[model samples]
Target: MKHTIAEVKISYHPNRLKGAVKITSSEYAGKVIRENWNQGTLNLYEEFKILLMNNSNEVLGLAPLSRGGMTGTLVDMRILFATVIKSGATSIITVHNHPSGKLKPSQADINIYNKIKDAAKLLDINYLDNLIITEDGKFSFMDEGY
Candidate 1:
């Protein structure tokens, strides 16, 4: 008997990188993330997104990873890293929104940030920032000394 093995294929589009939005700071990242976010749902529920970026800090794309209730969402580390790796992003910025309009990183948030930062270091990817977006503004872990 013969067995067949499935093959994995990754598709990358370099053309999209032209004139892409560049993330210079957490403030700019917050603005960009907000622009791409669904305003209708910004205050309704929790949503997590990842910003895939190239070496020049130009955004490749935004990937919505998970959605949850009003207070929190789940982030799968394996899926997160896989998405970054597949996109060929040299760095990443992770963002999540709080429906309650609070700009604070809970303890859980810090734990996950540490995990992601460590993983990024291991993979040689720059973990730019972890942002918590609210209706009013954003809280950046990097800016707050994560």
Candidate 2:
């Protein structure tokens, strides 16, 4: 008997964001990403999403990755890099919501961001910014020169 393994498949539709939505600054990208959040869930659960961008800083699409309870969300770096490569993105900005409404990144957050940044470097992909946001405010790693 012969057995075949399933092939890994990746899909991205043409639903590119508006061409005008250039992520020129952390503030701009944060605002645009915020609009994509699930309002009903934003204050209740933490969620992670990636703003995939092209060479021109044109947003290719938003990839919603994970969600968890009020405290935190889990991110799988393998999945993250796979999505970036499959989307044909040259760079990415990671955004996540803080249900606590506090903008500070815990040590775990910093550690994960560094891991992702290191992996992106190895893959030749630019890891731009990581935003920790609440509805009223946001903290940007790039803004802080992290």
**Best of the candidates, lDDT:** 1
* Window of ten residues with lowest summed lDDT in model 2: 12-21
What TM-score does candidate 1 reach? 0.95
lDDT of every predicted structure (CA atoms): 0.92, 0.89
Model 2 off-target regions past 4 Å? 8-20
Residue pairs with backbone atoms closer than 3 Å in model 1 (clashes): none
Local accuracy of candidate 2 as per-residue lDDT tens digits, 58-111: 898889989888998899998998889989999899989999999989998999
TM-score of each predicted structure versus truth: 0.95, 0.91
RMSD of each: 1.2, 1.8
